[model samples]
Target: AYDGGSPTRSSQMRLDIVILDINDHAPVFNQSRYQALISESLLPGASVLQVYATDADQGPNGDVRYEINRRQSDPEGYFTINAQSGLIQINKPLDYETRKVHELVVQAKDGAEQPEVGTAFVSIQVRDSNDNQPSMTIIFLSEDGAPRVSEGANPGQYVARISVSDP
Candidate 1:
């Protein structure tokens, strides 16, 4: 059985090798939907929340980078993401009266070439911020010439009317 006998009784030699996994896995978010509450008056660079994702692939395939998916629905550019850290930060001030809740689509991509992408929804509720100051105006009844308050002005008599408004 010198040949075509599967090397029996010859100096039988076999080698064992491990085939590593390829970079075929996509990044997966810890949660399908993430909720966060942030003050509307936060600074532009303020950190809102940190997003986390994991990949089953090994080596560079497991490394993830984050990004905000901007589209027609997301007209307001009020958020930014740190690619390396997956940290979401405020890009601008939020107005509760104008828009209360903001929905952002975040994508996580592996470091591999032609990396696979994963999407996650991050709902950010803009909390009320006491950043507005009330504006008021006081109007005193004036005569034809001007307002002249006498020293004996009656307390019950109407002196002035105040109006308040806020923007």
Candidate 2:
């Protein structure tokens, strides 16, 4: 550079710049916790619910995949998740008598080499259905081996013992 009235001089230089995409953002779930109620008779492979997550990064760093966190939830392998859609499905039969409620920890991870993950708590309440048949047992209270009631039996008189259970 030179003053306007004196002399002119110039210098030339080459400059190089590069922009890189980095995994700087972790996946974030739309909700911290989700709740759902489903009938115990719901068949396997049926959709339970869908979880959502997003990342602020670009490209692969923002592509999120879903999974059931086995270490934290679903030890019995009762549920499965779609990596692309975050749709959760029943992997096994649900029985309200066996398990009334199920708590799961769902995780979403970015496509980065060292993915940043986010976790969401999912509580599923299994509603009891009439899946089980009612069972009954009868015991005779008379001296004979058969259940019998006398015509003169008064109210609340013990005639036979009956037990019924539905589970």
Which candidate has the top score in lDDT? 2
lDDT score for residue 166 of model 2: 86
Candidate 1 residue lDDT tens string, 49-77: 99999999998889999988898225678
Tens digits of lDDT, candidate 2, 1-167 = 44456466666677798788899999999999999999999999999999999999999999999999999889999999999999999999999999999999999999999999999999999999998899999998889858688899999998888899988
Judged by lDDT against the true structure, how good is candidate 2? Answer: 0.93
Name the TM-score of candidate 2.
Answer: 0.85
Number of the top-ranking candidate, with TM-score as the measure? 2
Off by over 4 Å in 1: 1-8, 14-16, 72-76, 137-163
TM-score of each: 0.72, 0.85
Candidate 2 local Cα displacement, residue 32, angstroms: 0.4
The RMSD (Cα, Å) of candidate 2 is 3.1
